[model samples]
Target: MAGRIIQVYGLWVWVAFAFFIFVLFNQSHSPLPHSSGKPSTVKERMMRAEKAWETSVTLRHEMANKHPGYPRIPLFPAQTLEAFGKYPYTIWDFFPPVYTCPHDIQRVGRLGDGGKWVCGMSLYENRPALPASKAGKRTKPGTVIYSFGVNGDSSFEAEMLARVPSAEIFAYDYTVASLGPQIAGPDSSRAYFKQVQLDRMDVLDRTPPFMSLQTLMKNNSHTYIDILKIDIEGAEYYSFDSFMDWCDRENAGEMPIGQIMIELHLTDDENLNFNRLLKWWERLEKFGMRPTWLEVNLLAVTLNPNKADPRCVEYVLVNHKDRKNIMRQES
Candidate 1:
């Protein structure tokens, strides 16, 4: 009886051990959780979330850095605030400050009631002076002020010329928007002064009668240009060099120019970056011109540590001759 009892007890113990082993193996392989007493802390969860977010941001920044192109830098909030202060004025007003650019027979400090000034991508401000005479006299009927890239809009230039209506202004722009052939006439408001000259050539292309600046001046019999405004996109870097050469030839024995206004384009292109900008500074210095107004556009950020955007600031160069004249009229 005692032996039979021992055998049965041994069998029961082995069954119990086998059941425990089965449970342990099943728990290890099962996806569902066997609850543990302790729970995750709030601080731990927060730390994990923050770490994940930081990792993501770092990865994105790394990708951007490795990309083979210019990175876009957004304008700072300060720039927007500055832009607002110059309200009712174009982007050019924020630059070169108010009294920086030279004015010819025009008030420099006073703002017009509803008048628009000549505002360009680069720094230039055009304030109109009262007509040369009270009688609304016509000085030179055929006198023309030639601008290369008029595009479609002439409202700015037209308003400036209204102060000097005696001169017949000839603005040349090839890509001007076409309203219609009839709408192209000159009216009291600023419109194209004459028919659109559609010679599909760059200002440098030598295509005969319209090829060179010399030809244009000779054909028009224009001995002098009262106000020369040049804004030809990024091409101004090249065109201005050529134009200066022409000016040297014409002003050899004559007055160089009564007044000059130009919007110089600066870029990070091979021959037109910030270093080239310094070269421009040198050239303007030689011409007896100094920057009266400067407006920076902040076109792009450069990879080169020593370089920055060429158009970061637009400069308005004025002949030193006009500084006293401008200050006297304004003061």
Candidate 2:
């Protein structure tokens, strides 16, 4: 009955809420709270936090209007809010692991160090199923992949090429001169490497040149990236602002990114400024980047004994907004 009502209303929250009121009307006892009328301290705090978020959203719109282009920067809340107890206690508490994947997922790369998970494999498997005798060959029409912070570990990139023969990969790592041994796959020719670090700013003065995502895409003549993988230590904290800025603009072309496989590193700085972290996470969701899968990097926990929470986490996010287009194109 509830399902039928939800389908009819086309808005589950409001429909469910109406059902709740209807059920409460027939109750023997009144649903209203009793006269012990003191306001809830926690509730008051929650309300204030919600108001602050609303104000922040308005400010974000203003910022977007002020700067309408590809390199959109993220704005963080004032530090004064942190001085008061405005943010939540922990990151996990705020971000519950409840994001559900719309399709199946697969793990790519090495088992231990340099691996990550990717979503929407049904579309990725561009070729039809092969017989037992010819199982090795799986050719795809070609998908665009951008990887940041290779760190000489091309296991993931190599594996992705192996799975999708025609896939084109653009890997960046200013620190490393070249890719690892595993990157030398059968179709390794499709993979391109650049000695450039992914940075918030595109500054040529840097040793290897620190370029932003927008600049990188423009340079490569790539309007859309099929898969964007980032494992740049903790640089991801600021790297996404330009991407999100592009999403904010109506003039900017469609963001048909299929998936994002990122390794999030939670350093002491992020832990201290929890609100900023929270805002960053929320902004990703706002841009239709939905977290589908996550795994805590136990290696980080083992290494950082002083930190109570695991510092590194691997996440496989699917872009819900551009998902349909991916399916249609691949189909």
| Best prediction by lDDT | 2
Q: Each model's RMSD to truth, in Å?
A: 23.5, 16.2
Clash pairs for candidate 2: none
Tens-place lDDT per residue, model 2, 1-331, is 9989877777767788999988878674667657777654433533443444446556544544443331222222223556224422233433433445444567788898888777756566664333222644334335788999888788988888888744788999988998888877455877889899888878989789999888898898777788999888888877786767765764244455777888887675624265466578777766666566778788876876574456577787766556433632422
Q: Among all windows of ten consecutive residues in candidate 2, which has the lowest summed lDDT?
A: 70-79
Query: What C-alpha lDDT do the candidate models reach, one value each?
Result: 0.44, 0.68
RMSD to the native, candidate 1? 23.5
Q: What lDDT, from 0 to 1, does candidate 2 have?
A: 0.68
